[model samples]
Target: MSEKQYLLDKTLETWKGKRVALAVSSEHSFTGIIEDFDEEVILLRDVVDIAGNKAKALIVKIDDLNWIMLL
Candidate 1:
């Protein structure tokens, strides 16, 4: 893997099962605990959607993410 992917993988490893928020767009973001992930995507559980409502879960492509931060 590239250094970029390696770093991201490391970051995700630390954040796994931790509450986090990832933005897909300026107006779109989701909050949840990281349930699983790979180089391509992340699975978030007990999620709160951009609309601020409960969601069963969210699966986000890594390339589509604007940012991710601890919540």
Candidate 2:
């Protein structure tokens, strides 16, 4: 794999099962426990989102994220 992808995967592996907040854009975001991930998307459990949204499970695209903060 590419170095960038390797680093990303390593970071994600370390952060799995931890709580995180992901910013999709200036107007949207989600907070949850990182459940799992593959090459394409991440699975979030117990998701509670900004903008009055919530879900038991969320599958979000990796490319759609602006930033992630550990919580």
CA lDDT of every candidate: 0.91, 0.88
The whole-model C-alpha lDDT of candidate 2 against the native structure comes to 0.88
Q: Give one digit per residue, the lDDT tens place, for model 2 in 1-71.
A: 88987987899999999999998756679899999998789899999988668789999888888898889
* Model 2 TM-score, 2 decimals: 0.89
Highest lDDT, which number? Answer: 1
Q: What is the C-alpha RMSD of each candidate to the true structure, in Å?
A: 1.1, 1.3
lDDT of 1 by residue, 1-71 (tens): 99999999999999998999889856688899999999889999999977889988889988899999987
Stretches > 4 Å off in candidate 1: none
Clash pairs, candidate 1, are: none
Question: Stretches of candidate 2 above 4 Å error?
Answer: none
TM agreement with the true structure for every prediction: 0.91, 0.89
